[model samples]
Every structure is written in structure tokens, then in C-alpha cells.
Target chain A: MLTKRIIPCLDIKDGRTVKGVNFVNIRDAGDPVELGSAYAQQGADELVFLDISATNEERKTFASLVRDIAKHINIPFTVGGGISAVADVAPLLEAGADKVSVNSAAVRNPGLIDELSKAFGAQCIVLAIDARRVDDQWTVHTHGGKKATEKKLFEWAKEGQDRGAGEILFTSMDHDGTKSGFAIDPLARLNAILSIPVIASGGAGNKEHFIGAFKEGKADAALAASIFHFGEVKIPELKSFLKQQAIHIR
Target chain B: MKLAIIKYNAGNIQSVSFALERLGVDFHITDNAEEIKTADKVIFPGVGEASTTMKYLRDRKLDLVIRDLKQPVLGICLGMQLMCTFSEENATECLGIFDESVKLFKPTAQDQKVPHMGWNQLRLKDSWLDPSLEGEFIYFVHSYYVPVNPNTAASTDYIVPFSAAMKRDNFHAVQFHPEKSAEAGERVLKSFLK
Candidate 1:
């Protein structure tokens, strides 16, 4: 049986691990490679590194950091942030990152999703959607949740799947950094609408939140950054808790 | 032992190379038939669309080279799928080493995702891989799967019971990405190298 995944996301800035609170007030964590390796050791099913840096030089540094992470970490990992074109993805994949997540670029040109999935194969392309409830509708947000778009959550997700995105990493901007719980209603709806796996992100405060994400939200995976980064929630303990809850955790 | 990773127009080949590097083994990623033929063991790794990759292999005659190689060869993910008789992916014929067909996964339940992504446990039987890895979770990501057959060395259940790993003579293939499966996955590679 395929078990539910527990992912530890490391927000990267200037090639180092950082955690942003609601997309701002970044705090330094540690070296990405070290943190990634430690997470792997702690039984993290997968790792996601989101590069929050903007400069072209920092992008180069992130690629090299990706190579280093790939060399040290044995488990699968995904790299995302500011991926705008096919050219932008080639370096990261060549650097040995297993998958690359595309956000703003994919939304701007939905064809970018088609082109990426065609070129890199759908298995390696993750469509990451940051969304918040605006006036009773789940509105899509981009640029790290700073900009809102006209696209609705469910429709854009369906389009992403049709365009060949292998997985949807849906982060709820409303629930992010609040540590209350996952946005279950929206996540469940996303899972119901999309055939590909949906990874529930944001609002993971404790192990119970994870259970809600998997059992109620029906997420194939649950991702958290601050909790895992600061040792507030240890992965092994959480996995055991989920397993006890009959979640079939990996 | 001389080891060669057969290089083709496929994705994730770099990950395999890095995995071997972590294992402290010397290897060459090559498409040259002579190198692949002479190597004591060969690793055929790929991640891409079936028809396109098969065409790439056939264009370089790597398909024929792979089919004829007597050295123990291990194929991963799409590499494993292409080793089969045919693939439902674009209805393309494959290398025909395993005599199995790869079919797209049709989810039976709402939770059964098409790609079958994430870590899944394996039920091993007469596998060249480490027997201790039985019931251990290995990473998998593919929409299509090779159904259980005579060559199945290991099996996993998702939407349906499928070949997690298969073995027939010198050709050994796994649908999972052992390179990205961490320690247990490294054990699989080590078992093959042994």
C-alpha cells in the first residue's frame, strides 16, 4: 500500500534555510544540506526547498546548494520558487533535485505547465498553488501569497492537472502560520476535484492537524516548515502518532 | 567491477549517478554500446514519456543494445517500463525483455491518485534485491504500472497489485526510484552491485 507522506519544507534564502512567517519576517534556520539530511534521518518521507531569494546570483547559489543537497540527501526532494521558464528548471533538475515546483510562472502562462510537463515529464513537475478565501471564494494568490489573481482555486487546479502537473501542493494563505489546522474544507474539495495527488500545506500545528489533513482533507501528503524546523513537532513521533491514528504513514 | 549507467535522453539519470557516488562506486554514464556491453554490470535509468524515450533509444540503437546485453542490467521507473513488451502509454511497443505490458493506473477510489506518488511497501519474492527490504517502503512515482507477472520479483499494491520490481535472467527492473529511496534504496543498489 502507498503510505501517506510527511514532508518537511525548508524555505531557502541566499542558499540557507529560513522560515518565513506568513511570507514575511524570515528567520534563519540552518544550512539546507544539513537540515535536509537531518530531516531524512528523522524519517521525513520527502523534502521541499523553496528558494525565496530573487536575484540572479542567488538563483545560481541555490542551484549549487541543490547539487550539494542532492549529493548528501538520499531521499527524494523538490525545489521550487521563482521558476518562470523551462530554462529556469533545467539547471535545478540537472543539479539533481528530483522535482521542481512552479507557481507564478505557471499561473501567468498556463502553457508553461504544459511545456514543463512535456519536457521534464509530469512526474517531476509540481504545481504549487497558494490560495486564500476572498469573499467566500478560494482565490489564487502568487508571488509568495503577496499578489492575488483572478483564478479560483479548484478551476486552476483542474487546469493544472489537465496541463500535466503530476501533483498539486496547495498552501492555504488563510491558515498559513496560524498553526490552527489545515483548511480542510478547501483541501477536501481540491482532492475531490483533482485526480493527481494533493499535498496539504500550511496550518499544521500539531499531529492532530496532520490527522485531520489526511483523514478529513484526504491529502496524500502533509507539509510543514516551522514546526519541523524549530523542533516543535518531531517527525518520528508524528509518524508514530499518525500510524496509531490509522493514517498509513510512511 | 566495471559499472556503467546507460545514458539516454531521459530525466533523473543524474540522481542515479549521485546515488552511486554516495555508495563510493566508480561508474560511467554512457550511451556507447561498446562501453555498456563490456561493463560487468549496467544500470538503465530513465524518467520521461514512453514513446518518446523508446524512439530516442531506437534512434541510437540503445534499445537493441539493451535487449542484447548479457551483463546484469537494472532498469528504474520508465527504464523498467520500457523494458517490457509494450506500454499503454501512447500504445508504444517497448524493448520486450520482460514480456509484460505497462498500463495506466485507473483509480478505483477517490484517494487512489493516478501517479501513485510517495513511499510504498514491497512484498518481495525471489528478488535479487535484499530480502530484508521486504515490506519496507520505497519511493514510487508513476501513473502507469506493470501488472504482476511471472517476472515479478517484488509486488506493491496501490490502485492494483503491480510490479514494484521484476527479474528475468540478467535483466532486473524496478518501477520505484531506488536512487531516491534513502538507505533501504541504497541497500537495493548494493545488493545489485554484490
Candidate 2:
């Protein structure tokens, strides 16, 4: 059976693992390859490496990182951020990434989703949507949660499906870095709207929050950074707690 | 000697190659019939839907070539599934080289989830042991299970139970990735290489 995944996201800056709060105030996490191998050994189902740097040709660096990580670790890893062209994904995939995530650039040209799916298979494309609730409506945000786009959350999620997104990583801007808990309401809406697997990110403070995300939010996976990176919540302990909660994690 | 990794449109060929490289083995990844047949050993690694993978194999005449090979062949994950009779994931008609069906793991109300993704214990059957595949845990990530049969070399449990490894003549497979299984995985790969 599909165990609920415990993903430790590694933010990359200039090809190294870096961590930050609320997506800013960056600090070094460690070497991504070492951190990635440690997570795999500790039973992390997958790793997410987000390149926080803004380079015009940064995708190659991400691909090489994926290759290097694949060389050292033997688990599925997803690479996200700054992926623009359809062909840009091939390098990352060739480099050993199981999945590639696209953000603002994917929305800029939604057709790129279909092209990628057609070439690399749908299971390889993940759409990472950063959203915030405004006026009782979920509004999509772009450029690392700094720019609010006119696209409605549920609407774009639906469009992502039609455009060939295999999975949806929905992060709430309001709850991110807040440590309050997952924004279950919008996640609830996104879960109800999207048929593909939905991974909930942002604002996981404790084990119970993950339990709530699974039970109430209907999220297939809950991803957190600070809790896992800061040694506040360990992966094995989290899995054991989730198992006790009857949430099905190995 | 160079080993050949059958490379179609499957997703996991690179991982297998990397694993071999780690072991200091020279291997070639190719779909060319001549290249694969000429190698010392052949590996079929895949990580996508079964039917689509089988289609590409059949369309490219790989199905025929794979069945005729005399060298030791190892199939990993979806590659293992493609050797079976059929797969429920896509109602896939596979190579049927091995008489088995890939069954879906429909989670019980109390069971975990789909895509069984993690490490699990392995209980080896008496005959499957090549002296190297002893009791060990291997990483697995799939939604289907290969049913137990005469070729059942090892068994593993998830929500219920399923075949973790299978062996039939020159062809052998493990549902879990030996390449990704760390030291234990490295041991099994070494056994296969020998």
C-alpha cells in the first residue's frame, strides 16, 4: 500500500542546501547530497530540492545537482523552481529526478504542461501552487508568494489537471513559516477539487498537525521544513506518531 | 566486461546504471538490439505505467529479443511487472514470460495507502537463496503486487502479503530495488553480477 510520505524539503542556493523561514532569512542547511542521503537512510519517502536562486540558466545546475544526489542516494527526489522550457525538464529527469515541479513559469504558459507530460509521462510533472486566501476566496500567488496572480486557486488547479499535472503541491502563503498548522480549509477545497494526489505544505508544527492534515484535510502527504530541519520533529518519531494516529505511515 | 541495461522509454534505467557504477562495473544503457545482446548481462529497469512500457517494448521488437536472451537478466520494479502476464494498473498485457498477474493493493479501511512506498522486511523462500539474498529489507514503491507462485523466491508483507522476489530460469526479478537497498541491495547486485 502507499504509505503517507515524509518529505524533507531542501532549499538550494548556488547548488547547496539552505533553509529559511517564511521563504527568507536564509541559513545553511548542509550539503544537499549529504542531507539527501541522510534523509533517505532515515526513511524519507522522497526529497524536494527547490533552487531559491534566480538564474537564467539555473535549470542545468538543478539537473547536475539531481545527478549528483542520485549518485549518492537511491530514492525518488523532486526538483522545483525556475523550470521554463519543455526541454529543460529532460536534463533533470536524465540526471535522476523522479519528478520535476514547476511554479510561476508553468502558469505563464500552461501548454508546457501538456508538452512535458507528452514527452516525460504525466507522473513526472508536479505543479507546485502557492496560494493565499483573500476575501473568502483562495487566490494564487506567484514568484515565491510575493506576487498575487489573478488566477483563482481551484480554477487553476482544475486547469493544471486538464493540462497534465500528475500531482499538486499546494502550499498556503498565510500558514507558511507561521507554524500555526496547515491551512486545512483551503487544502480541503483543493483536495475536493483535484483528483490527483495533493501534497500539503507549510505550517506543520507538530505530529498532530500531520494527523489533522491527513484525516481532515484529505492530503495524501504533509511536507514541512522547520519542524524536520530544526530537529523539532524527527521523521521516525513522526511516522510512529502517525501510525499511532492510524494515519498509515511506514 | 560491459553489462547492457535495456533502455526503452522507462524511467528507472539511470538508477540501475548508477548502482552499477557505484560497484565499479562497466555497463551500457541502450535500446539497440545488437548492443543489448552483445553484453555480458542485461537488466530491464522501469518506473512507469506497465501497458505503455510494454507497448514501447513490443513496438520496438524488444519483447522478442528479451525472451530469447541467454544471459542472466534482472528486472527491477516495473521491469519485473512487465515480465508477468498482466498488470491491473492499466489493464496491461505484459510480456507474459512469467505466468503471473500484477494485482492492485486496494487499501483496506484499516490498511495504509496506495503506491506502497518504503522499506519492508523480506522473508526468503528456501530455494530463492543464491547464498547472497538472505533476510534483508529492500525499498519498494508501487501500487500493485505480483502474486506468489512456483517462481516465488521471496515474500514481503504490506497491507496484506505479496511477492517481494521471483525467479524463473535465466530471468529473475525483485519487487524492491536492490540497487536502492543500500548495503543489502549492493550484496544482491554483486550476486547477480557474479
Candidate 3:
């Protein structure tokens, strides 16, 4: 059986991890590779390193960091953030990232999705949609959810899939950071309409929330940051709990 | 062992090189037919479209070299698919190392997704792969699969039972990415290295 994946997302800035990580055994919390290896050791199904760096030099450093991570961590990982053009992706993939997620740039230029999918097989291109409910409609947001776009969630997601995105990483801005729960309705709808896998992101506070994402949202995978980093919810314990709940966790 | 990673116009070759480096094995990535043919072991790693990659392999005449190699040759992902007789992906013919046809995955259930991405357990049926890896999860990412055949060494279930790993004489192939499958994956690679 294909198991439901549990992913730990780490934010990278200037070649180092940002946002406080509370892993006790970590020698350097800023080291994304070490932290990523630690997470992989704890049975993280996969890892996502979102490079939040702003400058070109920092992006170079991030690419080098990706090479180091690939050399050390055995698990598959995705690299995202600041990936605007097709050229920006090769460096990351060449550095050994399994997948590369494009957000704001993809929204601005929908053709970018097609080009990316054509260049690198659809399996490596992840379309990340950040959206929030507005006027009873899910409106897509860009630039890390600060800027709003006219595209609606479902239509844009369908378009992304048609444009050859292998998977959709949908992050509900409304429920994000609230620690309340996942945006079940939207996630369920995305799965219902699209044939590709949908990874539910944001609003993962506890283990039950993960269960909800899998059971209710019907998410192929669930991703969370602070909860895993702060040791509030360990992956092994979470997987065991999900298994007890009859969820096919790996 | 003099290991040579067969390099073609495919993606994710770096990941395999890194995996070998982690194992502390010296290897060279090359398209040289003589180098690949003379190596003790050859790793054919790929992540790309089938027809195009097959064309690239044919253009360089690496196809003939690969077909003639007598050493242990392991194929990964598209490399595995190309080892088969044919592929439903763009209707391209393959190397015919394995007498099987690669077909696209058709979802029978609503939950079954294409690209069959993420970790899934393997059912080992041969000694080429470590028996300890039985029921252990490995990473896979592909829309096309080679169905179970006599060459199947390991099997996995998604929409249907498919060949997770296939072995025929000297050529071995796996649909999963052992380079990215963590420790269990490392063990599989170690088994191949042995």
C-alpha cells in the first residue's frame, strides 16, 4: 500500500535555517543539513527546505547547502522559495533536490508551470498554492500570502494540474499558524477534483490535526513546521498514533 | 570494485553520485562505452521522459554497449523502464533486457494517485536484494510501471501489483529511488555493491 507521508518543512535563509528549532541534540540549529538528517533519522517521510533568502549570493549558498544536504541525508527532499524562472530550478535539482516547488512566480506566469514540467518531468515540479477564504471563495495569494491574486483556489489548482504540475502543495492561509486544524473542505475538494496528490500544509498543531488532514481532508501527505521543530509532536509518536487510528502512515 | 555510473541525458544522476560518495565508494560518471563496459559494476540512474532519453541513449550508441555488457548492471526508475521491451510512455521501444512492457498506471480507486510518489513497502522474492528489506518502505516516483513478470525480483502494490524490482541474469532494475530512500535504501545499494 502507498503510505500517507508526513513531511517536516524547514525554512532556510542565507544558507542557514531560520525560525527557532528546538531539537535538543542538534549541535547547530542553523545547519539545515544536520537538522534535516536528524529529522530523517526520526523517520520523517520526506523533507522540504524552503529557501527564504532574498539575494542572488544567498541563493548560491543555498544551492551549495543543497549539495551538502544531498551528500548527507538519504531521504528525498524538495527545495522552494525564490524559484521564479526555469533557470532557477536546474541549480537546485542539479544540487540533488528531488523536487522544486514554485509559488508566486507560477501564479504570475502560468506558462512557467508548463515549461518546468516539460523541461524536468512533471514528477519534479510541485505547484504550491497559498490561499485564503474571501467572500466564501478561496482566493489565491502570492509572495508568501501577503499579496492577493484574482485566481480562485479550485480553478487555479485544476489549471496547475492541467499545466502538468505533478502535485499540489496547498497551504490554507486562514488556518495557517492558528494551530486550529487543516482546511478540510478545500483540501477534500482539491483531492476530489484533481487526480494528482495533494499535500495539506499549515494548521497542524497536534496529532489529531494530522488525522483530520488524512481522514477528513483526504490529504496524500501532511506538512508542518513549528510543531515538529519545537518537539511538540514527534514523528514516530505521531506515526504510531496515526497507525492506531487506521491511517496508512510510513 | 571499479564502479562506473552510466551518464546519459537524464536527471537525478547527481543524487546517485552523492549516494555512492556517502558509501565511500569511488565512482566515475561517464558516457564512455568502454569505461562502462569494463567496470566491475555499472549504475544506470535516470529521471526523465522515456522516449527522449531512449533517443539520447541510442544517439550515443550507449544502447548497444548496455545491451552487450556482461557485468552487473543496475537500472533505476526510467533506467529500469528502458531495460524493458516496450514502454507505454510515448510508445517508445526499450532495450529488451527484461521481457516486460511498461504501462501507465490507471487509478481504479479514488484515493489512488498517479506518479505513485512517496514511500511504499517492498515484497522481496529474490536474494539480489536484501531479504531484511522485505516489507520495508522505499521511495518511488513514476507514472509508468513495469507489471509483474518472470523477471520480477520484488513487487509493490499501488493501483495494481507492479514490479518494484526486476532481475534477469546480470541486469537488475528497480522502479524505486534507492539513492533517496534513507538507510533501508542504503542497505539495498550495499547489497548491490556486494
Please state the error at residue A13 of candidate 3 in Å.
0.8
DockQ of each candidate's interface versus the true one? 0.88, 0.34, 0.88
| TM-score top scorer | 3
Query: On lDDT, who's better, 1 or 3?
Result: 3
Where does model 3 sit among the CAPRI classes? high
Candidate 2 chain A has its poorest 10 consecutive residues by lDDT at A20-29
lDDT score, candidate 3, position A127: 97
Number of backbone collisions per candidate: 0, 3, 0
TM-score of chain B of 2: 0.94
Q: How many angstroms is residue A207 displaced in model 2 relative to the true structure, after the best TM-score fit?
A: 3.4
lDDT of each residue in A9-121, candidate 3, tens digit only: 99999989998999989899989999999999999999999999888888889989988999899999999999989899988898899999999999989999999999998
Model 2: how far is B98 from its true place, Å? Answer: 1.5
The TM-score of candidate 2 is 0.83
Q: List ranges where model 1 is wrong by over 4 Å.
A: A20-29
**lDDT score, candidate 2, position A211:** 78
User: Model 3: runs farther than 4 Å from truth?
Assistant: none
Error of 2 at B14 (Å): 1.4
Superposition TM-score, candidate 1 onto the true structure: 0.97
Taking the tens digit of each residue's C-alpha lDDT, what string does model 3 give over B1-194? Answer: 89999988779799999998988999999999889989999999989999999999999999999999999999999999999999999999989999888999999877889989999999988658988899999999999999988889999998899999999999989999999999988998998998
* Error of model 3, residue A121, in angstroms: 0.6
